[model samples]
Target: MDFLENVVSKERTLNPEERVGEALRQAGVSITITSITDVFAFAIGATTRVPVLRSFCIYTTAGIFIVYVLTLIFMVPILSLDERRRDSGREGCLCLRLPADYKKNRCSQKLLLEVIFRRIFGPLLVKTPVKVVVVLLTMGLLGLNCWGLSGLKNDFDRTWFFNPGYQRDFVSAVQDLFPESGYRADFYLGNTDYFREKEALEELFNRLSALPGIKNGSIEFWHHSFLEYLKEKKGKPIRIMNVSTKAMQLTLTRRPPPMWICKQADILLNSVPPVGAMNHPGKISPGLQYMCANG
Candidate 1:
């Protein structure tokens, strides 16, 4: 306003009508949208330009609404599949155990009978075809979840993912760097910062490496080889191990030793907390299904 007023006042000789037109030009609208790709491109472009439109604010808003509505529309079937999956979970989390540990289970005999009846025949025999449809749909969804979803389901809900892809990619990257023979587990010497003593890595690696099947699965040093590379290039050889002390996050990784080797190494590096006063990043492991506790 000040700039326009200054220019308008610049000429007392100019007509008032002409000054009004000059001020109008200065306050004129602006628009920019050049890269239009497909049908989506044209829709974005044609609606954006308007007479005396400052920025096509309403069109932008409507565009956003359109996107939201489309997402919800496409997502409806996915949600229905999800509900079916929930119905299916009753079958999945439901384990048809042989009551072998029935004595240890909290449920009494009557309660156990009720559970079996509820889980098995309740849906299978009694429910209508629609419910059966839900069962089949759920089975299909779960199959997709396990086989197709990869870690994508976690993006939808964390609980759905078995383990984050961070673990998968990290493991794969490590495997690529240091080949895992064929073992399913790896030994980790993790602490805060994870690379406590650069040399300690070789110790644990060599120690765990001696284990037979573990040789097939690679041992990923949270720090060793990287340190050697770093130090060999005159970079950092050793740095303080930054253990996440507040939370006992025992950060470690190891290719699982053969079942036999694991039986032996439990003395040194099983799930037991290491002697360090500080806690390590705990409660997480690549193979969450296994009993190997710490790294």
Candidate 2:
């Protein structure tokens, strides 16, 4: 053939397979695009199969649908008008004069993508049994979700997110080691009038302590209201005490100066931990110390 390569000593015609491969390569048909698509399809398939990722896939697909709908609503008319103009031999932009060669190059890949999408979703959406099964399953799940939501509580138990293995082991260890004594819940109240409202505050504390979940006599308020404490003193001036805005501070500790647990408007209360199983510190990880300190 005229396309045969010439060597110094001899001339050899290229193999048919080699010639075809070369032509395909020059036309930009190569493994790179196919490999990318294969990998992407595998990843999407794998992700869609996972329970957690399936929701994300569904949401992303819905978002894509929304974008497509928006594009159709806003862009189809403009595109149709442009096509009409082009057919009528009217050009708006100089860039339109050049044929979009990239479209030709991507024809095979476009066809492949179209085929893959149709194969993936067409039968499931079109077939009677498949569609029925999908609808029934979706309705069943939706009903289950509604039933579950009906029992949802206002309080969130952060322990639900703890590692299962760690939680099981920790409960076993705690049950083995300290079956008699468990952790307690500490509640803090700020902006309290401890001294002036001692009776009311103490009543609230007693009521809280009496709750079946709270340990008996474990409830203790560290800060007594200054106004209330002063009123009890035998010789305290009634007028001065009534006029004064400050409360006396008392520290109860091992050192000479005990840490006053209360200031003018703040109060600290320490009590038995709430008796809920979820209140167990073992259920919380990484932030156990922070929860204990702040919660």
Candidate 3:
């Protein structure tokens, strides 16, 4: 659109090819700058961790590249062809020949915005008083923006991602009723020797429990339950040595362990109970799902 406007706004004395070339030259810098900025912005967005936002950015970046290529390779030649048709006194889409006097009758006219900017705003902007007022207004706006930034707070509402429906309404109602309700955070450990690192893991649990803003009595480490189970089974104090034989037996087994044995093994060697499970009182068992280790 800008290219077409530029071509039309050029001097009527120029030929079709000259008008097209001049328009391309005039519009190239602005178009290139805008396309580069847009592509760069979306490229940064593509690196975001959020799945929806990353996908959106990736598709939009591809679209911008495609459109930029089409503008140069396709739009320019089409505009040149249209300009040629106009110059030869042919109708715009149909190419029907018009009267020979049509070219002479048609006069090049300035756009309304171009006329206003050249006649009124251009001269007014140069006057000393007008320049002073413009500077003062710009400074005032800058100060006001800074003042607004000081009061701005960052917040995210999960409901913002959902459309207006029963689900969104329910979530908004819950948030309004329980503004202090906690959300879940999951942590995973890989290739850990839970038997050797028991003290380290216990210290980690204690540190998590000591953190401010954590709800009291919400930390649920599976080791705590396993310890109690062992105390009940052996009628002795909970210690890693008591389970050494069972751990060895499981490790030396040729066949896969039973489901209950697998669950116990997962709790002993791999799992840590979720920290904030108490927040969801209605949930019967809110912990990591245990999977059996393959033999």
For candidate 3, lDDT tens digit of each residue in 99-177?
A: 7665442335536777899999999999999999999999999999999999999665666789999989997786678
Comparing 1 and 3 by TM-score, which wins? 3
Top candidate (TM-score): 3
The superposed Cα distance between candidate 2 and the true structure at residue 5, in angstroms, equals 46
Candidates in order, TM-scores: namely 0.19, 0.32, 0.62
Candidate 2: list runs displaced more than 4 Å.
1-103, 106-109, 117-176, 191-193, 222-295
Worst 10 residues of 2 by lDDT: 278-287
Model 2: lDDT of residue 271: 25
Q: Cα-based RMSD of the predictions, in order?
A: 32.0, 18.5, 9.2
Alpha-carbon lDDT, every model: 0.43, 0.45, 0.64
Ranking according to lDDT, highest score first: 3, 2, 1
Better of 1 and 2 by lDDT: 2
Can you write out model 2's per-residue Cα lDDT over 163-237, one digit (the tens) per residue?
A: 778886776576569655444454555445434554565566656655555555554444323333444553554
Best by lDDT: 3
- Which segments of model 1 are wrong by more than 4 Å? 1-181, 187-201, 235-295
How many Å off is the CA of 210 in candidate 2?
2.7
